[model samples]
Target: MYYGSVGGNATFLLNLPPDKRGLIHENDRARLSELGEAIRNTFRTNLAEGSSAQASGTMSGHQVDSIFDGNPDTYWCPEEGTEQVTIEVDLKAETEFNLVVLQEHRYSQRIEKLELEVQQDGEWKPLWIGTVVGYKRICWFDKVTSRYIRFKITESRWCPRISVFEVFCG
Candidate 1:
């Protein structure tokens, strides 16, 4: 019975008290973890291929479009007095994305925490909440639609500024 069960590629091992039912051993648990990883990798997809980004406020020389200019040195810094800033991205066409990549100014810790939202049916819905992100942050969540991606900065370390180099959705 052990030989047949061990090599049968079974996903679940039943444990019963009446007949000393088999309990999944280390090998079986390892196999299950591998299976789960394979499933996640198989369906992962990037949905933010050609989206355009926009911001709520910009500084004197730092414009909102700087984040998408494909230059690391150029970044978008929010205007003063706008304590809470937002950066919204228009996906052009509706799509599904489960990952968000935020690239901050090389070594700045200005952005301490932020929230991500998506537009659905003309209303904005919360998607993900990011915290303790210094330079770069990759946020992952269950697949959601990408009509309008909004990144709101709620907490900051200093300067009341929202500085970001690039933001990617996938």
Candidate 2:
């Protein structure tokens, strides 16, 4: 059996019931293989590859590196009570990409307003600006070539701390 659900309160889950209740019969192997392939194709490329990130500030014991470590359990949080925070990613070289993905810390409403920018002529130019909520946000815009990406948190929740699990451009 394959089980998943989303609820009114931003709930999402994938679970397997008891052995007898959720058993995957031998015939299901083919279906599972197809599902696996679909997932692989969906994430075939991650533009954040070979990139390095830096943030304006990080809360004690939480480092900026956690944001790109591919682990949702780890996160990057700005200093307590910070008014604004900027996290920058160096793409190593100019590359064309149209998507910026931000995954926030689970169960937290931290980011309110975000601005996506690229370094152009030594100045940061806007690519997209919008409000964000929930655990994930995907921003799409016209493709741009730049070596650096600046993710600015212009507004945040009451704590005023910016916390995120992962950020990428693709």
Candidate 3:
């Protein structure tokens, strides 16, 4: 609910009903706490944070390596008019992740279609495909361990600019 709500540009609200004594039910309180812990555990660390990033094309001043620097101000943009480009991330070690979160620069053109791939046995295999990445897109796939993964922008209104590229398990 948290990811789906935020990813779709909405706020999530969970209404808790209290007992006749005006105290929140223990079951409800416990469940809510569990939900909070689950979310925290899933996103506690980004598997790709501070790792190496490479792209097929890049515009001046927007280096691909800045994607995981934890800064939203900077972004990676492809060369002018480059419709199709691929961004690859090196986690430095085989790590398992099932979720990919991508956020576009605030002012860049929207990405229409993007695909995720993982390298296995020297071959790149497709994992997930997404569309309409207006501001953020979350692709959830089966958990897999890999040292390398890549995101390809197949269609965009213009050159796609990515401000945040994150990978996680959950």
Candidate 4:
């Protein structure tokens, strides 16, 4: 449920059976905790960190290269009047990854739709299309081995302000 819902960009409801006392079974609780820990361990490292990052167009203060700094306060924004833009991340070498994390600054959510693509064999191939990133969105797909990845913002309420973009292997 967690992987499907998160990867498909939908909210999910996980149900765990509870007893008459409104307490979950011991086994179920333990399993749930184990799953949570596994997920945490999988994403503990951001493989895209410190990779070369650049945007099609960049706003002065909100330079796109800062997206990997890990600070939620600083963000990357495209030039004014630009509703669509692309940010390319160079992994420095071929990297294998299956998950991506996107975060929007807390002030507002402007992104309406975006697509992720990978450069394979000198060609760009689509991976996933995401919608409405409010605070944070976690997307996962089949593992991809590539040196270059692109984040294309197709639709937005305005110039999209992105705080963090990260990639993880899972």
Candidate 5:
């Protein structure tokens, strides 16, 4: 499988073909390199403004907790306060997809909540939700059919801080 670290505190899982999977253990160097390229491309396209580094750079733990305190539309939660961050995605086919969200707590000992949503009938609906403890990572998967996708961060104690958030699609 190809895993990407982006978009949230999760790993985006991309299932590889049988041949590719078989080579992972015996030829991990080449397999990992290919996987890295795929992940980079995925982030380049899905992140806001087609810039993953830029998007990530704008957020911190303080930013996340105070997002609503400022302009909700333009303000970003601090990487530490980012209860959850998501991206709206356009998929060509309906399939089971998986991704990981990694949360790095700057002060808090645990994440309050993390979630994913899909646009439905002009509304954003929840597709999945979970919790993370300490400074750890979590994984989630679901079958979805949508042209647009977004990540939702619900609750956190800190104000800002994040190392990275990426997405992987298949």
Candidate 6:
């Protein structure tokens, strides 16, 4: 079953209960398919609208930083051959901030031990870490109160190619 509304646009997929499945006529599959399509279209529309607003620059740089794609040069994965991009954000006087890193792993090999780091006291410190498996698009979000921020791709068995990096302040 699926359900959604514009203001609280949400969709859920669930397996039919055994009793319900047994009761459904073969022809009912067509109606289920139609409902699935409608819910998917609604989600697509909402996503497109949100993306459009961010691209239009109506959103503040800080608020929309998660959606911003920084220069490609700012990323470094072993397969990318020494290409590393670093962004430094000053959080002076700010109580909180977030860093969003988007990466695409397209190689057949998987990446292991992905991590993000922040600069503290002139040293790099780990903030978060994870693993990337197969052809996955990884979005990493880190929230901190430090005065400086940066990202570190700690480990990769294949290659880590990032599509974008953005920092937001709050």
- Name the top TM-score candidate: 4
Estimate, for each residue in 1-170, the C-alpha lDDT of model 1 and write its tens digit.
32123222122364523333555566667766886686456435434445567777778888766665656787777776565788888768877667666666666667667899989999999998866555556666788876788989887755333333323333
Local distance difference test, each candidate: 0.63, 0.68, 0.85, 0.86, 0.45, 0.41
- Writing each residue's lDDT as its tens digit, candidate 5 over 20-71 gives 4455454656767876887566544322122212223234333432221222
Q: Residue 120's C-alpha lDDT in candidate 3?
A: 91
Q: Using lDDT as the measure, name the better of candidate 5 and candidate 6.
A: 5
Whichever of 1 and 3 has more lDDT, that candidate is: 3
Ranking by lDDT: 4, 3, 2, 1, 5, 6
Model 6 residue 99 distance off true place after TM-score fit, in angstroms: 6.2
Model 2, 1-170: lDDT tens digits are 11111111234443434356577655566666886686466457776765788988888878877776777677778777875788898877887787666767777767788788899889999998877645656666778888888988898875433333222333
**TM per candidate:** 0.64, 0.70, 0.85, 0.88, 0.41, 0.39
Q: Alpha-carbon error at 73 in model 5, in Å?
A: 25
Q: Where is model 1 more than 4 Å wrong at Cα?
A: 1-50, 159-170
CA RMSD per model (angstroms): 11.4, 5.7, 2.5, 2.2, 9.7, 11.4
Higher-scoring candidate on lDDT, 3 or 6: 3
Which prediction has more favorable TM-score, 2 or 4? 4
Mind sharing the TM-score for model 1?
0.64
Q: Tell me model 1's lDDT, rounded to 2 decimals.
A: 0.63
Better of 1 and 6 by TM-score: 1
| Candidate 2 accuracy as lDDT | 0.68
* Candidate 2, residue 23: how far the Cα is off, in Å: 20
Residue 83 of model 4, lDDT score: 91
Distance from true position, residue 37, model 6, in Å? 20
Superior by TM-score: candidate 2 or candidate 6: 2
Q: Identify the runs in model 2 with alpha carbons over 4 angstroms from their true place.
A: 1-42, 159-170
- Model 4 over residues 10-98: C-alpha lDDT tens digits? 56667777988899988888988998899899989999888888899999999886789988789999888889999999989999999
